[model samples]
Structure formats: C-alpha cells, structure tokens
Target chain A: MTTNKSLFLIPKFITTPSQNGVGRYVCQLQRVVLKFCKNHGSSRGIREFIEYDLLNFANKNPEVVVYLKPRRHRGPVIKAEYLNGDDQIVFCHNNTREEIAKWLNLLRTQSGNHDGTRLRKLWHTDYPSIQGPWTPYTFRDPALNLAEFPNEELSRPLDQPKTATEELDELFKKQQESEVAESSEVK
Target chain B: MSVLKRVQQWATFARIWHVYDATWQNPFQSAELLKKYLMGIHKPIYHPMNDCGDHVIVINSLDIALPGNEWAKRVYFHHTGYPGGATWTLAWELHRKDPTMILKKAVYNSMDGNLQRRYTMERLHIFPDGNVPPELMGNVSNQIRQIRPMPKRLDHYTKEEVEKFPKIIDYPKDYILR
Candidate 1:
C-alpha cells in the first residue's frame, strides 16, 4: 500500500540478449568485488560468508572473477559487473551470511542490473502468434469486398417482424379460401 | 523490428471506414450504435487509451426519425460570453437550420465528456443525403444496418399488386365511388 514512485518510475523492459541455457549457457556476471572493513561490526556477515561459503562459490562458477577489498572502517558492499556493461551495487549493512549468499546467487543468474527496474510484460516470444496477428479484414465477409457502399440489402436490419399490413392480408386470404370451400361443397 | 512485423503493426491499427443509412432510424438510438464504431468499442482490441477508432459516414441525416414528441420537446441551449446572449433552440428548429446537427449532437452527447471527445467527433462524417464525395465514399468498406425497418407506403406497391389484394368488404354497384 506504499505510494512510493521510485520503483514504478524506473524504465521497464523485457529480456533481449543472453538467451542462455537454450543451446549454450554463458554466465553474464563477469566480475564481483566484495568490499568490507576488517574490524567494522556491519562486516560480520561478509567475514562469515568469506569463511564458510566463498570457497564453494568460487569453485562452482570459475567464470565469475571474485575480488575482496578490505577497507579501514567502511560498511559491507557487493559490486557486480555484467557482460552487458551493467554495473550494480548492493549495500549489505547488517545483513546475515545466508542473505549475502542469496544476493550473490541472484546477481550471477541475472542478465543485467535488473534491480529497481520493472518488467514491462510478463511474457516474451519470438513468434507471437501461430495464426498470425489480426487485421481489420480478418473474419470479414468476402462478399462485402465486392459490394458497393450504401447497399440497400446491407442497410436493412437483420431481424424484421411481420407488419400489420401483411397480417391483414394473410387473414383476408384465409377467409376467401374458407368461403370458396363452402360453395364448392354445395355444387 | 523485422519487415513483416512492421507491416503487421500497420494492419492491426488501420482505421476502417463505415457507412450507415439513417433513413427512418431514431437519432438517439442510432447515436448509441454509432458511438461504438466511432470509438472502436465494437472491436476486440478496443482500449480507452488506444487510438483505434474508425471513421463513420452517415447518409440521409435528413430522414432520421425522432421518437415521440422529441422533435418539439427537446431543447438545445446555447450562450455567448456576454449577458443576455443565451438562446434555446428546439430540436426541429435545429434540424431545419442544419439537417445533421440533431444527429451530430446526439452522438456528441452520447459519449463521456473528456479531452478525447472532441477528437473522436472529428472522425464522424454526416451528410444530409447519399451524395457523398467520391474520395470519402471510396474508403467505406462496411455498412451499418438501420435500427428500424423502413415503412412501405401504399403508393410504393405496383398497380397490379394493389388491385389483386384481398378486400374485406365490397361496395354496392349503385354506390358512387369517391
């Protein structure tokens, strides 16, 4: 229910490049730099991630280049660069070791810096329709293409009820037929 | 974008031209019907923000019927910026001044008053008769049906057809014809 416009105001787009895992998989995350202070209290999560999970992560994805920068008293930060020239920074102040591992995984999988940006559409396709897109003439009567404009046959309403004059004419015809039958029986 | 995709975009958003015969059709009723085509509400891809409306050419505006006593009772008001410049015109009087005004107003008032209303009205083309210019008529690909059936007059029947019609009562030979 928050009415903040910052998330909504960001440019929206669909994934265009790096259609990975179809025939070949190329990891877009080129390099990730983990910045943290050795003695700061906020860098406890970073220190824990480096001890328990950093070696496993580096061995799993040898394509990604990981660099550690130990500052004097700065907070923890993760700076990731993509092959598509997108640079993203995640501030990990007071974050747990588990949260830091999840953030690194998300950055490795994404094609670009997609944080704070919205997806314009949920669906994407190379061939949008198998039956082709609709045009004005789709399902239109072929006879109309040859017919002239303001045609009387086309102008009349589709459903027309019997008029009073036609009803009266039908009644008179029935009466005449009954009278004729009576005269023929006498003969 | 590919060449085929660019052409597909043009085909989907093309504006269709429609012709409607207003003979014996009530202006108010026809307005509601025409409003759909004028604003592209009848299409499957209709969106309030999209510019997908079509052009409507109305013929025989002079023959449009007004239900009940609306011709006399309906009042159209107008005013100038200055004082004592207000005037009220009856529907019949307005029709007499401009044959297409009544129908035009009916359609104009049928839609919601918004910034797009004026632009939507610009696509409507009204003619008093069927004598539309060749340029406009050439673009018409579809015809909108009339709301009511056109009543047939006695004179419209052929002489032989009228003579052969069944009669309920016969006049005496001695009785003179009027």
Candidate 2:
C-alpha cells in the first residue's frame, strides 16, 4: 500500500544531460576514478571493460576524464564526480565486463543527482505571457469602466433569443403597422 | 497569494493549471491565451528548444464564442489528398459536429511551426464538458479563471424572480399581451 507517499516526494528535471552545455543541462560526470585490486576476483570485470571498451568510450566522449587505480586485496569501486560538485560512489563486486561497461555509460549520462526529492512544480518557464499576464482589467472593456454597476442592459444576457410567442407577436404587430400605412396611402 | 510570492515563483517554479470555462468568450482571443500557456511563453524560463512549458487543461469548450459574424464567416479547410476530397467547414457547423475541434484547431494553428510543436501541444488537454478524469486532476495545481463571465442559465431563473425584475415601460389597461 502506498501510504501518503505522494506528498513526501518532490519532482524535478533530472539534470537534463547537458546537450554540449547548451545552458540548460551541465555534464554531471566531469571525471570518473575506478579503483580495483590487481589480483582480486571482482577486479576481473573492471579490467576487461578498461582493456576492451575504455579506449573507444574515452575517444567518443572526450569531455569525461577517466582514471584507473590499482590497489591490493580490496574490492572494486567507481567514483564519479559531477560539474555541480556532487560525487557518486558505486561498489561493483562479482559483476561481468558488460555490466561494468554499462555502469560507466550510466555514470557518464547522469547529472549526478539521486531521485525522490520534492518537486515544487510540474512545469517551469523563463518568459511568462508574451501577450501579457491577465489581471482583472486585462480583457475588460473600457466602456464598462464608465458605466454604472447593476445597470439593467449590461446585466442581461446579450445573445438571448426571442421566445416563439414573442416572435409571433412581433410579426403580427409588423403586419398591422404595414396595413395601417397602406390604408392611409390609399385614402 | 501575495504578488511578491507569485513573482518569485514565476522566476522559479510555476505549476500547470486546468482552465475550462469558455462561455461567451471569443475563440480567437481564447486561442491567443491558450498559446501563451502551451509554449510556456508566460514564464521567465521560456526557450525555443527547451521544453520548459506547463500543462494546460481546457474544459467546457463547447460554449466558446466566435465574435461578430465569425460563426457564419469563419471556415475550416482540410483535404484527404484524393481528387475533390477537399472539405471546407464553417465554424458553427464544426462546433455542431464536434465542440472541441474549434478550440483545438485554433490552438494548433496559433503555435509556431517547429519540430517541437507536437511535443508542446501534448501538454494541452481539452475536454468537451466539465467531466475531467480522476487521473488528470492530480497534475492540475491551479485553476485559471475564464476571460469572459459565464452567462446565466435559463433554468436558474424563477417566476417570482422574473416578476420582481424592474420593467422599463407600463402598458395601458386596454392593451392585450399575447
């Protein structure tokens, strides 16, 4: 059961992986430092990804700096540094070469922020209302300002249609008026 | 909310809204207003490529007004690509066929022709009437008031109320009103 979970979390723009630093997104991972044991079983995958795919990946994304550090009798760990001064550390043990490469790619694409924070708004804007922000006076007619309130004509609906009976009465009155004018002309 | 707080939020985080009422409102003017919210043009963070727009929910679109003689004069045209497959529909006829299409077409045509236009339009949710689904209500953080006031319905008026209303002229005793 999701008990009041919606109120606790904030929504955000998951650091849009800056498309070549277009101003909206900034590359989260500036540098990645990989630490692994030279002779350990867990170090095998890290060693393989670095040997096979590391060079090509580095050539493709020259922006991210990669460093490989070898230690003795320790587990393998990946440290990712972001442009926002935030650090993400991941532990990789008993993982295959493919999985290690996948993790490296994930780190490269991320903006270095964890999920589940509160989002103040669903949308954001830089240039609000090109026409203008609406106020009480935005679309108000200038004539309304000069007119008095509770005026009968203004209060009534403008496009109200005439009732069938009223229409018939008006038609009959028009016929009578025409008949009277014709009688006078004949006289 | 205070003006200062609203200005601060405009500079930072402004949420989306669902504004429905279009009763007695000019469709052209209404389209202009819709375009502002759709493109996120109403916020300080608006960008051409950046998707920094807010979601807009429109309901009661059937009652949107077309000022002057636009209902008779304004026309919507479309083609099926086949020979003599073209069709031109008047504004009133289109509204009679589908109430939502007029507003939708108006908003669609008002947007800039760009690759991101379809994505921007996705943020706009329009409904024919007042029945908004349960799922979409969660995203609506505010309600924007309609530009024109909704006219009073006939059913809301009572016989006593009508009798009490002031009259401009009093007819003679011999005169008969049918």
Best by TM-score: 1
- Per-prediction TM-score, chain A only? 0.78, 0.63
Task: Give the true-contact fraction for every prediction, in order.
Answer: 0.87, 0.00
Worst 10 residues of 1 chain A by lDDT: A7-16
**Colliding pairs, model 1:** none
Q: Estimate each model's TM-score.
A: 0.82, 0.44
Error of 1 at A174 (Å): 9.6
CAPRI category for model 2: incorrect
lDDT at A61, model 2: 83
Which candidate ranks first by DockQ, i.e. highest? 1
- For model 1, what share of native contacts is present? 0.87
Q: Which ten residues in a row have the lowest lDDT in candidate 1 chain B?
A: B161-170
What stretches of model 1 exceed 4 Å from their correct place?
A: A1-13, A16-18, A39-41, A160-187, B1-9, B48-50, B165-178
lDDT computed for candidate 1: 0.93
Alpha-carbon deviation at A33 in model 2, angstroms: 38
Query: How displaced is residue A73 in candidate 1, in Å?
Result: 4.3
